[model samples]
Target: MFRRFALAGFAAALLFLSTTPVVAAGLDAASINDAAAPPTRLPDRQQLSPSIARLEILLDRAHFSPGEIDGKFGENAQKALAAFAEANGLSFDKAVTADLWTRLVAASEGAAVVTYTIVDADVKGPFLNKVPVKMESMKDLPALNYTSPREALAEKFHMSEALLQALNPGQKFDKPGDSIAVANVLDTEKPAPVARIEVDKTRQTLRTFDAAGKLIAFYPATVGSTEKPTPSGTLKVTAINKNPTYHYNPKYKFKGVKSKRPFTIKPGPNNPVGVVWINLSGEGYGIHGTGNPGKISKAESHGCVRLTNWDALRVAAGVAKGTPVAFVESSR
Candidate 1:
């Protein structure tokens, strides 16, 4: 029997908005949208700055995904800015120059952050109380759903859950019709067709190109680890599965999974492979999403190319069977 769970005890019936207006915090929508690029470059250490958060949203809208919008100038955000700079033929290092900032702001759409009203679909979820940490224990669950409405909304806006809460302090995510500030990072139109894909193990990033060799999209990725390295050379895409059942093979001996026997995990947002799977021609290797978006390029993967769930979905939508995917040792 499948156990259904309500998200954060939210009522099935959608609630009307209260008369109270949502107060803006230090990292509020107004601040984010009104923020300007710092005259100097971002600090080397990760810090919560409204400007960085705004920059991240703009990068996300432009398809140079900065893993998750966590209001920090981390390595993932750095990589994304670097990729964006390179695509625009601008010189960049660990810092964002004035020219780069101007180009990014010009390329992006309206505001970086906008007010979004919560809806019934956003709150009404048969969510999971908790996802198991071990792979063996996950097979028995009916489905891997989002743990809370906050998580769903965060992923939907391409923002981190922490950022979501930080932006809306003291507000419970359980009510529909309640206003919340979210990243204006919606990509309504379908992506252009991808001609080729490049997975850089050294850089821990993925890039897609058009038929004319124009860079289409760039994403920070967690490639294979030392335990099981990803394949080299070019490979063709075999298949793309939007909702994939994760079949665990015993031979690979993935650490922390004590099960010697084969098993299959049900598909949902919190599944081992997340929501999408782009299978590669190389045996036992593929590009897929991850349950943990925050640990994207910061963590290690078994042997597959791991992208954020949204990034994986974007890639899956743009690519087709026989799309050339090349794995490189280094971009240098």
Candidate 2:
């Protein structure tokens, strides 16, 4: 019976994302318009689509704190669910599924999940214009290899992917032969401060909090390895460097090749450290960007908290000298 329910749930999710012809192929204006046209009233907890409800339950079990699980897909619920999905090698899309629920349950039971929260609103942009741009031709655009075209745009604009998606939700990127609208890009306003960081060692999660204890954002992180346990204590952001030239010292015990070349990689997403570096006042410890976001919170770092390049940049921008950071073992 459980298996049958799971399979049925998965099929329903497919209909939600694929069969919904009105939904666009990428983050585009049409999609956004459709999504914004009439806010579909979310079902009650008992009436929620099985997959979504299962996802909520699993997230709650994993300690993701998906607000009130009345089964309504609210902003808080979506954010929490996305964070959990991202941690488990799933896309951040708010859609839920049986597989996702199963994996989440397994992680909770077996101790494999992690969570992070945004404590501050630091690095602002690439700001997104309320209005989307009309792409005359995607024929000239690059292949859609990554997650969303907006994500690709974020790369082009040198801004956080999360910010791009947040500004333009449910938009489609493909317009076939017609021109598709793209949102106007804006400059980052000002850097703000992150208030708190909640690190769950058991679930291998890290969360950030604001002074008011509100969750601004969240991300998965790679902590220290068993050989080199991550240092515990309250750390503070001492400095932030953008497009930093990494100083690879052979003595530092890095996993990759030891180069005498002092390999100074340029900034951008492909950089070894991604784009931003939050230097912590706690000596050699700091939170920095990573070339591999998919492996975040799942892999081990040298000792510092490792986050996705986009996430790290935002965190760095929000943080400053004396931003307090705490690392704790996760109960979930």
Candidate 3:
């Protein structure tokens, strides 16, 4: 009976494999030698240019959530892809290959695209406007930070890196600053609410809530590691400092920094924390920026909620000193 069951399972597997459609066209040695051979178009119905806008949408649909889908794929996109791949049992190669595309399509099948229209009330000012606009290509944006080459284009446009990958579906972004067009626009008025963070040591996630207690953002975060765990208690924001200078004291070396190291670093993105610093009520512990935004939710920190510079900035602007910050093991 066991042998029969095994045979049946093998047969089913073979049938499934056989039913899987083969999409790649045959390319012979002659085709490889023929310089006149036309380029192979991607499987998608539309011909998407290698722009950041397209990449941003793709990454967004894949549930990587590259923050804002600005266009230029960057460090955030790469981080999102790595996390997505890990969760999906795929290799974190950063390259969006045919296999990755298939998985993304499967993952984004039920995903919803919320539309937003620009309103007079939504427009902050000349410098900041929540306008309903569209772009032909993500290449129109300026250069992006290239920590992860796979998602460099997305970063350049100040867009969400994960969304770019999802929009492109099966296409790979090997080159830096690749351009792509984004067809969708913010056609309605549905603004995303402010982010409220709830640190949970047990689940290892920073749950973001809105004014109504509705969970809007959820990010995996590296609280204090096992050896130097994060302090368990409630804390509140004391102050928000932008472009903060890090006073690196050797005595407080969580990562074994020698005493001879520099005492302080100038305010810049490369500082110990990235660009923003939110001082918590705790003397030494606080939610601050990180030099390595990609490792925000992955690696352990000294004893703080380390967020990406952009993420930290958003959180800082959304909350105040009196805003309640709860540090709990779990929601329950």
Candidate 4:
């Protein structure tokens, strides 16, 4: 399930490690293409762009997740289609056609878009005005909640907030009495337990595969920066924590911190680690969720890899304590 929005965000870049250079100079502008999922050579979307989005949603529901389902037949969708085709005993490089359409429709259970009621709970509660950039400054907040109700709802339905807003221009997302339409794509299929996770720092993407080396899930990520580069070797997932409180040690000397002492950031979906923290064996490194889904693969992190909260949860849920997590420079 997607995360719900709430107030009380404790901004954190994790306790820093200045042995490396200070690397969190967030970029000013980011493009959609900045978020590259693993690409495939397979032919895509013979139809219109919306048709491509629908096909992506179908692929997602049928257990092959294509990153964010943004309705673009970009790299991620092509990869997902190729994976699905190969799994179903069809040629992986074939173009989109009637045969593929028949298979997808048969595998899919519902429409790609459906009407959803925005309940009071989904829009309820105190919301955070904004998440703080420095964890050291937060002394009173209880938890790191979502920055807005729109974010909470978007996570609930697995769509970007901007895309959700575009789908319903006049609806008030923050209020209780709004019925809206949203992407019906949900990753409910239990994937084969993930055998390994590859973190491509160059491409800023994470790919998960089963024992047979079939790609099952893909996500755009913001890996470590130049100053705080992620470990350049293989690691393993040490632990998984839901609603993990972030403890920031002041010794690392992260940028913009006036405090000289350590602090603890409360746990919530908007926390630096977002909803779930998949801890890696590498020292102070792992894959976790992020507050800004849009900036994923575009922004730089202190040293950890970051994905959207929902995507992280989807991948984390399927992994185990000993799952291999490899950090490598982009192969593509």
- Please, what is the whole-model Cα lDDT of each candidate in the order they appear? 0.84, 0.48, 0.48, 0.67
Of 1 and 4, the candidate ahead on lDDT is: 1
Estimate TM-scores for all models: 0.91, 0.49, 0.49, 0.74
What RMSD does each model have against the real structure?
7.6, 14.6, 16.5, 10.9
Q: For model 3, what is the alpha-carbon lDDT of residue 211?
A: 88
**lDDT, candidate 4, 1-332, per-residue tens:** 32222211111121124442221222101211121222333323321134555666677677566666554566666666766776677875536755666787678565566666677888775678888876665545887777677878887776665455545545568767666766676544565689999888887778898899977766667888876788888899999999888877776566666777777788888787888999998877878987777576767888998987888888888899999988888445
In angstroms, how far off is 269's CA in candidate 3? Answer: 2.0
If ranked by lDDT, best first, what sequence of candidates would result?
1, 4, 2, 3
Residue lDDT tens for model 3, 1-332:
00111000000011113333221222111111121211233233122123333344444544344544433334454555555666567885546655655575554332122222223322222221121122112113221123443333443333344443433444355433333322232212232454456888765556556788865444445577765678777787788888876666555655555445445555544456667788878767777765455565557888878765655655676677766667888642
In candidate 4 the C-alpha lDDT for residue 257 amounts to 64
Candidate 1: residue 287 Cα off by (Å): 0.7
- lDDT score at residue 7, model 1, on the 0-100 scale: 16
**Candidate 2: worst 10 consecutive residues by lDDT?**
1-10
The TM-score, computed over Cα atoms with residue i paired to residue i, of candidate 3 is 0.49
Clash pairs of candidate 4? 7-127, 7-128
**lDDT at residue 312 of model 1 (Cα atoms):** 97
